[model samples]
Target: MARSFTPKVVTANRLIQGDTVWLTANGYWSSDICEAEFITDAGTAELRMIDTETQAHLVAGAYLADAVMGEKGPKPIHFREDFRTRGPSNYAHGKQAEKVEKNV
Candidate 1:
């Protein structure tokens, strides 16, 4: 029997800034995973990956990541993806910085 398809979201690192980004429903790349398009089927995930991969100049390491629906939006299912959502770990910068500033 064929393996069941798991829900996923397309993700990659922006080539210019190296920030982790997800493919939104409108085809825009968003830094927030909550804004990601949650893909439920294997066929749609494959097609999305094919289109996303073609944008090599804008992004790198594009792939489908396991995710689930959240109260706010899609959420990452894996530790690696969850870590990526937090931006760089070395310091407070990028998304992390923005979040810190907002909390103050």
Candidate 2:
């Protein structure tokens, strides 16, 4: 017996900067995980992974990541994916910095 396929999203790290990114439906990368395109079809997920890998200039280590439907959109099911969305942990920089500034 085999496990059923779960929902998935395309994810990768930016080549130059190594920032976490997700693939959107319109064929582009988004920093916000909520903007990722979720696919339930296993075939489509594999095909999408191939396409995502072609953009060597954009990303590296491209692969399909498990996701779940959230109120906003797709959300990371794994702790690793959730942590990537936080930008950085060392200090308030990148997305983290932007968030802090907006809150002030």
Candidate 3:
């Protein structure tokens, strides 16, 4: 069964350099160009990357569900198949993949 999109709010420690972030629900987060924005019945709500200190808005992309927060704020989410290839993956793919993999 296809899952319904739930409105969510999440935060990140920081967005990667030269990457865009988005407003998942209320807080801020970073996502790749392929996963940033979505057109909903409400309107076009984009995943906007911003500088933590400067508050500058970055580029937008598609929405990613795996990149969500847990009970703790800004907790990492494993959203891609590659990351999950070996058991319950803890790695966040893309730029964060290497660091996460090493730690795991």
Candidate 4:
């Protein structure tokens, strides 16, 4: 039997800055995972993948990531995707840096 489709979110790295980004409902790429568009339909997910292809100038390695709807928005289903949302792990920069600054 075929596996049932799980909800997904479109993710990629910004081509120039290498920031992790997700496709939003408005068609813009957002660095925040919570702003990602959560797609539950297999067809819609495939269609979104196609849309990502057209945005090659802005992003790279575009693919669907399993996700679930959360109070804030889409939440990643795997450790890898969760790690991506935190930005670079190299000594606190990017999203990690901003978090540190905010807590100061």
Candidate 5:
């Protein structure tokens, strides 16, 4: 028996900055996962991944990653993807630092 296709989003890392990015419906990349284009069909998701790969200069490691449609947008379905959304875990650097610096 065949399993149904789960929702997904095309994801990649910016070639220069190496920051995680997701493909938007406008055929562009955004650092915010909430802007990702939610694909509910496996075939469509695969096609999106291929299309995203054509922009080699803009991004790399382009691939279709599992996701679920949320009220805001697509959310990561796996631990790795969820972890990536939070930026780095360092308490003194990255997203964490930005929050701390703002509160000071």
Candidate 6:
């Protein structure tokens, strides 16, 4: 039997240092940092990756997912680059921005 596609969101660490990214959908990601764009359930959410110190927002991607249920809360998501660079990134969900600066 063919498997059904499960709805999912693509999220990544705000500070990713890599050339290419692999989102949930294979072959749908971008290598050019300038072309990065968030993929959400409602559709693509335009985003920019900003340098924490310089405050320069570079075009980037963001993803969405169903809010986590009871106790679990919203699960955190990370980019393929982040995973390869630093293993699985810590989950922050709503506070991802705040947590990004802190060491994992």
Top TM-score prediction, candidate number: 4
Write candidate 1's Cα lDDT for 62-88 as tens digits.
999999999989999998888888867
Model 6 misplaced regions, further than 4 Å? 1-10, 16-59, 76-104
Per-residue accuracy of model 6 over 28-71 as CA lDDT, tens digit each:
34332222332333323222212212321322344333222224
Q: What is the lDDT of residue 8 in candidate 5?
A: 86
Local distance difference test values of all predictions, in order: 0.84, 0.80, 0.33, 0.84, 0.77, 0.31
Q: Per-residue alpha-carbon lDDT of model 3 for 7-26, expressed as tens digits?
A: 33222323334332344333
TM-score of each: 0.85, 0.83, 0.27, 0.86, 0.83, 0.23
Off by over 4 Å in 4: 88-90, 99-104
Cα shift from native, residue 30, model 6 (Å): 23
What value of lDDT does candidate 2 attain over all alpha carbons? 0.80
lDDT of candidate 2 over 2-104, digit per residue (tens): 5699999998877887777888887888877788888998888988978976788788999888899999899989987877778667887766555321100
Q: Which pairs clash in model 5?
A: none
Candidate 2 runs further than 4 Å off: 99-104
Q: Which ten residues in a row have the lowest lDDT in candidate 5?
A: 95-104
Query: In model 3, what are the clashing residue pairs, if there are any?
Result: 21-48, 21-49, 22-47, 22-48, 35-62, 36-61, 36-62, 37-61, 37-62
Residue 103 of model 1: what lDDT?
10
The residue-level lDDT of candidate 6 at 73 comes to: 25
User: For model 2, where is the 10-residue window of minimal lDDT?
Assistant: 95-104
Per-residue lDDT over 22-98 for candidate 5, one digit per residue giving the tens place of the 0 to 100 score: 88888888877888889988778778867875799889898888998889899999998987766756554443243
TM-score of 2: 0.83
Model 1 lDDT, residue 71, Cα = 97
How far is 27's C-alpha from truth in model 5 (Å)?
0.2
Residue 104, model 4, lDDT: 7
